[model samples]
Target: MGIYKILKTAILSLFFIVTVFSCKPKKAQNENLLLSKKNQLKKAFRYPNYLNKNYILGKFDYMNSNNFVIVPKDLSNKKIYIRKEVLVAFLKMQTAAKEDGISFKIISGTRSFAHQKRIWDYKWNSKYKDLPPLERVQKILLFSAMPTTSRHHWGTDIDLNNLTNSYFTKGKGLNEYNWLLKNASKFGFYQPYASKKEGRTGYEEEKWHWSYKPLSQLYLKYYNEHISIEDITGFDGSKYSKNLQIINKYVHGINSELK
Candidate 1:
């Protein structure tokens, strides 16, 4: 009887030891995975600095009415388009502007990927080639992108007011721009890039660009950390060879005269 009790106690002790040993490695691995996820989140939320080369201008693309907000008056024959969510925010902006006695209009929004390619080719082949590479890059960055790399493609960004009259210049008193800076956020809008700091951003300051804050903020967070220029420009054209050729021919070659 004594021997049986002693043997039972020994077996129970061995079982407890085996269970603990089996669990330790799994617990350690789980802790490591959680730590890795935490780090990724931290990186995503950091404030963006202009100096970051990743701060390339986002590409724009033309989307159908379903993706855009159409202002009835602005739709005059032309299909007026802006990001669906942005259009809603713009409506809010318009209401706020009305209260403040300021008028706001969307001068431009959403360019098709093909259209962007054309603008890029025109700028690159035209007078841009005469300038230094860095300068050329800067110039192009102002109004265009290197084919397929524009945020406007997402249909969530827009330029307010006419480019000619409401050009984004530094230190220009914000009489009009200021109204947006103060009120846009209330409508869930924000300027992703501003002109005050040139040393950091290779592109020119564009006060006119406003993003629907909720989406823009999320995009900014993801883009700042994970996206790369290669992802924007590298598309398999063969899948849509004809469309690609069209983009290459008409859109890219449209401004050949300037080149």
Candidate 2:
């Protein structure tokens, strides 16, 4: 080939390669941005009614995800129900644990708003009497207050148990818990308020509280953004209380990490 033609062809080839490579990254970046935008939009408006009479704790909103499968009434020794995606992941985790002689079980899944209220009243009247009303409300806000705010109201959170005991406490370490820590993310699960991160969450470290990965991310984002003092009050307040004000300060001012 002529020298001029050879140089021209090499330049064109290089230009084509560079253009294609550059375009690929741009395409990927656009896709990522689009996905992030979608997530944000979903988070902005996806608030569940924690006080709805029909709200069932531990029961999956099966309509929300196509991957959900009904747990066999017989196989689930307990009446606990979970999202199909969560069940699949849990079963897989169980199978993997058995290989190492570990067994896993579900102790608590969902709770009705009424049930939550009862617990709240019991706890408040029995254990938190010494706390100022405002402080008590602030503390419960970190977790759930019956008929007002509860992740368990969403049916995506689960309280798992070791084979020996279901109630969670310090020194109740089990291989299943470790396995979940390492592998639950693969199936879309995470301990949202891990004991290690208690300071940030303002809640007790719950080793057994695992959320379905996908929905939890959405809920966390929503919980961060939508459940403002205003929103919580709107849900169930007869009058403004000091506790509500404290909750607002933390939720709106400090814990504003929602994406």
Q: Please report the TM-score between candidate 2 and the true structure.
A: 0.58
Instruction: Please provide, for model 2 over 1-259, each residue's C-alpha lDDT reduced to its tens digit, 9 standing for 90 to 100.
Output: 6999999999999999999999999999999999999999977963555422233322335345453444544435567656666677777877777787766667766555555667777657776767877666656555554354566666677776642223443344655677777877776677755653324534545666777766655654556544544444322231444344534433222222221
**Against the hidden reference, what TM-scores do the models get?**
0.59, 0.58
Judged by whole-model lDDT over C-alpha atoms, candidate 2 comes out at: 0.58
> How far off is residue 144 in model 2, in Å?
4.8
List where candidate 2 sits over 4 angstroms from the true fold. 1-78, 138-146, 162-172, 196-199, 222-227, 233-259
Q: Which candidate ranks first by lDDT, i.e. highest?
A: 2
lDDT accuracy of residue 170 in candidate 2: 36
lDDT of 1 by residue, 145-223 (tens): 4444456655667777645424533334356687876767777776655543433232345677776766655554455
